[model samples]
Target: MKPAGQTHTLAVVGASTLLGKEILEVLKERAFPVARIFTAGGAETAPDLPVLDLGDSYQDDVLVEEPEDSEPDYVFLADRLRPAPEGTNLGLLHSAERLAEAEHSKVIDLGGFMLPKAGGAVRIPSLEREGRAPERLDSPATSYYVAPHPAVVVIARLLLGLSERFAVESAVGEVFGSASEIGPRAIAELQKQTLNLLSFQKIPQAVFGAQMAFNLLPRLGRGRTQPGEPAPLERRIRDELRDYMGGHVPLPALRFVQAPVFHSLAVSLYVRTREPAPLAALGEALAAPGVRLRRISEGPPSPVEVTGSSDILVDALTADPAHPEGFWIWAVADNLRLAAVNAVEIAESLKSGGP
Candidate 1:
């Protein structure tokens, strides 16, 4: 295991996009102890953000100048291996897999490069071939683990901590993905079309299959599978949840839909409990640490309202007398922020020793 209380250095490979920016924000918000921070992106100018210039490699412990006082640690190829200077501490990777090949003291991946298996151990066929498995790490020390999307992981941990009687019956996710989720070109097109007044005469479908302005696309990536078949994202979530819950809880049925909003993701859950759960108790339970509960009388939650908010907004906690088993509620969160924050939390958990 890695030594505790060690000052670490972090490098974010793709730090130009919204998720990347949010990752920086979350790290600062949490006040994570860091000796240096490195941010790399494809863009020439990332205004208001401090990033290292990878123009050339510096000697061990060398410091470079930025426009401001802030600067990153070092720059490694997204997939190429670049060793940090000897005696370096930990690496927190977000949304970049190639960096995993780097020769760091310890690497905490925020991408889904590895999957937790039905059994206790994790599966990393790719890393295994490269001779970078759990066993490779000095027994119990210097171990590496893949962390799943932060939002999903944190929510799973929160729910498991709350109660065992509650079952996530069904979940509907309205994802307000950032423009960066698609790419830079797609973002440029969206802005161009917005200025052009949604006229298809000039703009063509680029990032998304359809023109995504003043309109919402229900589907993302591709078509949903058959009724019984799970969508790709949904399947991943179910599988990961089962692994995290350790089969102690049942997997919830899920539905995912994409909205036109620029950022954030909102999910509404209808839970069925083994015993009747009162609305007040349910609200209080959800309002526990890692979740934010909102109370509303008339209108439903929307993506526009919840964008840029860190907490998972939970409202519409209404008990269904017809369905005596449980009740329903709405939850909203900044998807990228949730993902970024959750990733940091997982790293912290692993560092502290997880349950």
Candidate 2:
């Protein structure tokens, strides 16, 4: 680990993005030490944010047009840069590569795109052993570190926690994703669609390819992600869970549905263990750092209530009547905030030279 007072230089690639902004907020909230900070992005990014002059080739250097300084020690690809768009599913791997090579910075991708296209180490701070670094983190070949999708984190953490006490047989999960998961464009389209529908006007469907105001979609509309394939979000969650779970537990059967809400993510999970486990014992296992257990009397959590909370709010625990080993769990997490926290925590671990 670096010395107590030592600091590192940093940069955020999509500083103006929803996740990018949240990440900055979390970094500030956690008081990450920094000797300098830099930012870059497309037209939507703030005018003052420096634009990196990355040429067409990987051989090109990461040239900062303003705020001349040495390359940052770490670079965070927080979201996709707009206008010069790098599609929804692939992210800006080319840009990330340039930043990592030319600038010589350790790149951490929060953009859900990188890992699926190109391999990387998945980091979930909550799951790591207390002090020892995971082998992936210590490996020289791992160039990028990824923060798992919020749904993946919630499901993985819950199952991992439960497995500590019971032998989990299998599980199934239904994730309700919100507009903000797609970024500001989707949020704006949903808002516009809502207002347009109320006014009896034709609703805009450009961003989501359908009226997303009050309707739910199994996948995006026409011109958006195709219905024949696994939704990108679902694929992402599945891939992440596979890596994070690391064969320690059975991978849950998952379905991702796009919900009308503008923020947060919710999951309804059914878990079957090898033996019947008491609710009291399961609750004890579920309570841990970065998680909140709500009492049944307090009512089930809603996406709205979990919007700003960093902790994953879990409640509405109940046992299945027919299957002695079966039970259901309902969990809600601030989509952006949970992801931001996980990213920041990963940075902290990297900063401290720990897992």
Best model per TM-score: 2
Worst 10 residues of 1 by lDDT: 50-59
Predicted structure with the largest lDDT when compared to the true one: 2
Model 1: per-residue lDDT, tens digit, 1-355? 2324664565554455545555666666666665556644433223322121112121223221221222233332122222333443333232234333444423444444323311122222222232322232223433344444433543454354335335544433332344434444555656665656645456546666666767766555445467557656666665655555444445555655545555556665556776777777766655444455666765666655666665666665878778887666666666666666655554455444541
Which digits, one per residue and each the tens of the lDDT, describe model 2 over residues 1-355?
1225978777776766767777777766676776665666632432222122111121022222322345666767776533324332223223544444543566777866455444677888867853112234343575578888889889988998888778999999999998778766777777778888999999888778887777888777664455466777788899888877777889999999999887899999999999899887888888787778888889788998888789899995889999888999999999988888888888888878876
Candidate 1: where is the Cα deviation over 4 Å?
A: 1-6, 40-104, 114-142, 154-158, 165-180, 183-202, 221-231, 298-301, 349-355
Q: What is the TM-score of each candidate against the true structure?
A: 0.66, 0.84
CA lDDT scores, all candidates in order: 0.48, 0.74
Per-residue lDDT, model 1, residue 260, is 52
